[model samples]
Each structure stands twice: as C-alpha cells, then as structure tokens.
Target: MKKIIILTLSFLLICFLFMQFFRPKIVNSPASADFQAPPNVKAIMIRACYDCHSNATSLRWYDQIVPVYWQVAADIKHGRESLNFSDWQKMAPADQKSKLWEIVYQISAGAMPLGSYTEVHQNAKITRDELSTLKAYVNSMAAVALPDDTAKINAADRQYSQWRKEQFLIKQVPIAPNGVRYMPDYKNWQAISTSARFDNGTMRVIFGNNIAAAAVRTHHIQPWPDGTVFAKVAWDEVEDKDGNVKTGAFKQVEFMIKDKEKYAATEGWGYARFKTPKMIPYGKNALFTTECINCHRPQKNEDFVFTQPIKH
Candidate 1:
C-alpha cells in the first residue's frame, strides 16, 4: 500500500510537469473598429461569446492550466476560424449576414457559449430575453439584406441548373411500401415561407401545421416538437415576356417529419420526396438519403431546414 501511494504521487507529479511544455500561446489582437452593435446586444455578445470567438479572450485561471488550457486553445482556434466577431467588417456583406444568421440559429439551439463553457461562466448563459434581443437585431439586419442575398444566390444557382437537374434526376430513389401518402389536408397547412433554387430550376413554398409554425415563429425552441410536419411543394420556374415569373411544371414535393424515436437514424427527422405527377418516391437508396442529409447538415441547428421564417 505504501509503495503504491508513492508511485501514484510520483506519476501525477511527472504528468503535471510534462503538461507545462504544451501551454497554448495566448494571442492578443485588436478588435475590429467597424463591428458596432447596440449597447445591450454588444453586452450580451461580449459576455456570452467573445471568449472563444474573438481575439480578445478573457482567459480564466484554469484556461492557463494544462489539459484544460489545450481544450480552451483548440476551441478558440476553431471558433475564430469559423467566425471572428472581431473581424466582422472584413468579410463581405453576404458573409456578414450569413454569420449573423448562424449566431441566431446557434444561440436558439443552445449550441453556443458551449455547455462546458456556460458551466464555468454562469453569467455567459443567455436568458430568454437576451436571446430575443439578439434575434431581433439579426432579423432587422436580415430584413434589409436577405432579399439581396437571395437574389445573388439565385443568380449563381441559375448558372448550375443543368448540372443540378442531372444530379438529382439520375439517382434511383425508392418508394417505400409504407411511404407517406399525398394528403389533401396538408395543402391547408399554414404557410411558412417561399424560396427559389434557380440552380435547380425550381421554386418552393413551404407549409407547416399550427404546431410547426408556432415552433418556427418562437425562434428559440429547438428540435421542433413531435407531431410537427412540414411540406414543401416545388415547381419549375417559367418567365413571360413581361418579366413576370410563374410556377411551371410540377417538380416534386418534400416532407420532413419530426419524431425523435421514429427517425433516429436521420437525426430525429424523417425525409421523403415524391416527384412528378405520379409522385414516385425519391431517396429509395443510400445514395439519395446520404445526399439529402449532407445538404441539410449546415442547418442542422435549425432542425435541418434551409428556409428560415420569413421576417415581416
């Protein structure tokens, strides 16, 4: 027993001593002068997000010690790489808007400030009110910028229409025997928003029943409540000589259902798409499902839907 005690202490001391060699280098850089916000919003951001996401990190005592320091350093590195609030003005307007959207979605999903970080800095945890303020700010900016951003995105997509059609149409998606049937009632579901994918030659209008619409409008709740279902109807785009654009041929209809246990394989959401008049099932094989999931991965925090609630 005596020998074991001494050995354990000696081993721990050696490990602690060795950890000193791996101390992460702390960097200090000036914050961007143009990154201005409302006083309250800025305060919330500084308190909740600046540590890992900005150059001006306020390192704590444990942040300077050993393994914890390594984790802190790595997180700082990754956060800065993903988004540096300190360098906000340096990014293009579209990029800035995009990052702000990410912030809103992440905070809403409780994925920011990181659980481990909030555990240590209780003040960093955002209250519902603070989240609302932040979201409001983002929405205000988005209201002015999203139309331009969407136009730009659609323009770029138009250049890739042929390629997109070829990619989606070539896949052999299967129709399950127990697949979702077309429900006439879904047409009366509350309209959520409309979007266009010029690159795919398609325009889409999304609808969700009361439960799902309420979840989207709330903006802070996540994993949308079970029983919520979203239907997105898509059609080809056609333009008249007068520059009026209208829905053309029917493309497909896609549905996303939220049922945690039922769709565990697809991250708590079940995806299905039916194409053309016959409504043949799509995503029958692994290739189809993999592609769908990959495309939605970026918006996983927002329940895997790319179409955000239309700001009024």
Candidate 2:
C-alpha cells in the first residue's frame, strides 16, 4: 500500500512538471499609456486592477506554476480585450471616460478584480475609502449639458405630447439592426423598477413582460427563466424651479430578451434599442450586440441584468 501511494505521488509530480512546459506564453508589454488620475485613485487601481487589466502585470511565483498559469494568461487576454488601461492612449477621449465609468460600476458591483483573482492576490482587495475616492473622481466629471433653456424645455414638452398622440396610430413597427422588433405593447406591461441618470438628466422605467413579471413575483430571478423579457424606456427629466421633476421628450427604449440557447454568444440575452419618437433603431448591424454584452459583463452574476425588480 505504501509503495502504491509513493508511485501515485511521483506520477502526479511528474505530470505537474510536464504541464509547466505546455503553458500559454504570458505576454508582458510596456504600457503605451498610463491612466491619468489623482495619486490616491491611481494607487488603488494599480493595487487592485493592474494584474489582469494592464500590460505591466506583476505575477507572483505561484502564478507561474502549471495549470494556474494557463488561466491567468487567458484571463489577462480577455481582460485586455474588454478594457486595457495600458492602452488608454489608443482610446478616444469619450471612450476613455466611458471605460472609467464602467470601471466604477464594475467595482461598486463587486464584480471586478475577479473573485478568482482576489483569492490569490489578497493585496487587490479594495477598501471602502478607496471606493469612495474612485467614485468622487468619476463624479467630478459629470457635467452633463442638459436642456437648460426654457425654449428647448418647451420643445421637449411638445415632443412628449406628440409622442403620446402617435400611440393610437397603427404603423409598421421598427426593427433593430439585430432583428428585434419594437415592442409597443411594453408600455402596458408591469413597471418593475425605475432608474434616474443624473449625468444625462434622464429617467428610465424598466417594464417586464408577462413571463418576466411572473419570474419576479415567484422569486425565480437569480438566473431569470429563459422566456423573460424586459423593456427599459428613457425620457428626458424636466425639473421646475420648485424642484419638481417630470418626464419630457421620449428618448429611447431598450429591450433585453432572454434565450440561453439562442443568444448563447451574448450571455443569454438579445439587446435592442430604439431611439427618438421616430423609433429609429440603434446599432449599425447585428455585431453591435457586442457593445451591449460588454456593458452587461459586470452584472454577470445577476444574469447580466442591472435592475432589481420591485416585488408585487
């Protein structure tokens, strides 16, 4: 029995040694650009995010070991594809801001510095103070040029009235670039949640179709059953001097249709957006769904959904 055990241990050791030679090449490059931020914010991001997110990855000795190395290599590759702070110089100004905001969202959601990563890199754990620093930095850039003039606000009000009038007219429904048709009946569905975007001066109401509504009521929402569908409609938020706020012009409506088998590539949800009263569809082609999927990645644990339904 002792001899057999020895042999088994020796075989396992040999296999582990051999696996090291088959490791995926870890590509480390000098960062072409460094993310610009205050010293505190920069330090936090470097400690928590640089491992898989930046080109200058400081891997530990244990990370260089066999099977684990393969996962780290793959993670770095996918992470860079999602957002590479090292290549920040290559991104457009608007894109840089968008990615920074996304970083804030992902971090706040506890979806970043992945659980697998933080398990090994204990120093990557973010503290509450660090989170506040990051949030404050991002909020400082939120100077949204909303419709400030009374003329423009009145025009938006007029547009809202015209939009309501158009609901009665039977017309050809617009289809998105990805083939999702405009779901007009969503207006009558159960509104499950509301989101206010102060940055854009817009308010969004999320409505769930019958299947989705049923899922919410039954608490079957962790993965949310396959047939579930949600519609999020956005409109400008008009505010009076008295601090009262109301909806202005209709801006856009987005949908998330679930089908694990069908939308397997897009995290089990088909996304579509229709903008303006004209109902002009968003996206240039089917591939535009990637943008939606990438934005939803941080909510992967919640089945790529950002909203928590208001229980019936």
Candidate 3:
C-alpha cells in the first residue's frame, strides 16, 4: 500500500511537470501601417478580433496554462486562417472589401468570435447598436465596388501606392499644445483642437490618419471641411497597482459640429472604447465607460479622436 501511494504521488507530480512544458505560443503581432481600419471598427476589432485574427494579440496570464494553451493556439490558427488584418495588403482590393462586409454579417448573425469564445470573453459580445453601426459601415463598403476589370484595379493600386510614397516625402510642420513631436523618421505628430460642423446636408470635419479617413469614406460619408474640426490622439504608458506596465494603445479624440453651419462649435468628444477578447463575450457595455470614454472626456471639444496628423 505504501509503495502504491508513493507511485500515485509520483505520477501526479510528473503530470504537473509535464503540463508546464506544454506552453502555447502567444499571439503578439505588431500593428501594421499598411492596412488601416476605421476608428470605431478598429476599436471593436482590436478588442475582439485581434486575439485570433491579427498579430496584435494581448495575451493574459491564464493563456500560459497547458490545456488552455492548446485551445488558444487552435483558435488563433483558425481565426488567422479565416482572416488576418495584418495581411490586408496582400489581399486584392475586392477581397479586402468583401471581407469587411463579411465581418459585419458574421457579427450581426452572432457567429463571430464563436459563442464558445464569448463564454470566456464577456467583452466580445456585440451590442445591438454596435451591430447596426457595423452593418451600415460594411454595406457602404460593398456598395462601392472596385472597377470590374482586374487590371484596372491593379493599376489603381499602383497609382495609389505611388501617391502615398510621394506624400510620405513631403515636409511636415509641427503643431503642439497636445504633446506632438517630430521624429527623424519623418512622422510628424501634432496636437490640434477639434470641433464639428454640419453644412449643406453634409457633415464635414478635419481628422488625422488615413485609416480613420478610409473608415469614414468607406461608409460614403462626406468629408468635413478643412479646419472645421481638429483633434489629436496619443497614448500614455503607466504602471498599474501591481507594478505592471500598462499601455493605453489606440487612444483617440475627435471634434465635430453638432448642428449644421457651426463648424467652430465643439461637440462632446470622448475616448473610443475597446475590449479584450476575454471581456467581449460577457455582454458587458459598462466596460466601454470605464476602459474608454472616461479618459476621452478631457478633450470633449474634439469629437473623441486624437486628431494628430502623421506624414504618410
């Protein structure tokens, strides 16, 4: 009996040790500049989809466990196989547009991130309003199909790429009062005040970043007039109570005119909300208030996006 008890304890110890060796590869892809998503869409995708779909996964401590590690790896593999935002440039224009549309459908149909995913990640659950907004955005993208001819699309892409390269070379003026600085790499950060204006049946405002612009453009919204509204976005790193470095990535600020013809008037701007995969599945909306909006209120005059311009 003594020998049997000893063997049992030894087996349990071996199992525990073996489990530690089965650590899963964590997803930690760098954010790519080549592909940009809209502020709102980007926020949602980062919180929910990035874990599996992109290289920017924010791994949690539990992900290091053995069985759980296997599950995470499998999910990430499947997610990336289905769609990878990091590789958006590699896809044809049509494919990119189509995939954006599919994202909306999947989210609306409650098929995204998988129910199993949400069971563990309460934040991944989509609210009705969020779903509606996403649907509208996706539909707008689908409405504007690239020219049917494949060669024409390729030609357009080449032209766009050249234009972007040229834009990158242009000298940038520095603007401040919002913590922007010039880097040797030609990226100019600016701190700009923001406001909103609606005029002639159109909403117009100045914004920073092509991703935000493309997100707005894809939705078929008219651009705000130049200088009508200005904003700046930045991230600050700080340590948590536990002395862990906490990063506030994807911070944003925006300003917009609430009524028509009053571009100078400031509407409320707040931090855009984002959630992690773990929080997304639990159907929690309050997380937005805590994790996102509170910090953004300081720049309420802007429409809740940090409106700093980057040189290409």
Best-performing candidate as measured by lDDT? 2
Candidate 2 TM-score, true structure as reference:
0.89
Model 3 earns a TM-score of: 0.42
lDDT of 3 by residue, 262-301 (tens): 3222232222221221111111332333333333332233
Error of 2 at 123 (Å): 2.6
Name the regions of candidate 2 deviating beyond 4 angstroms: 144-147, 162-170, 198-201, 237-248, 309-312
- What are the TM-scores, per candidate, against the unseen true structure? 0.53, 0.89, 0.42
Any idea what lDDT model 1 has? 0.71
**lDDT per prediction?**
0.71, 0.83, 0.48
Model 2, residue 53: distance off in Å is: 1.0
Worst 10 residues of 1 by lDDT: 143-152
- lDDT (0-100) at residue 214 of candidate 2? 90
Number of backbone-clashing residue pairs for each candidate, in the order shown:
3, 0, 39
**Largest TM-score belongs to which candidate?**
2
Task: For model 3, state the Cα shift of residue 235 in Å.
Answer: 48
Please, what are the lDDT tens digits per residue for candidate 1 over residues 27-75? 9688864456899998988888889878889988877888888888988
Please give the distance, in angstroms, between residue 190's alpha carbon in candidate 1 and its true position after superposition: 14
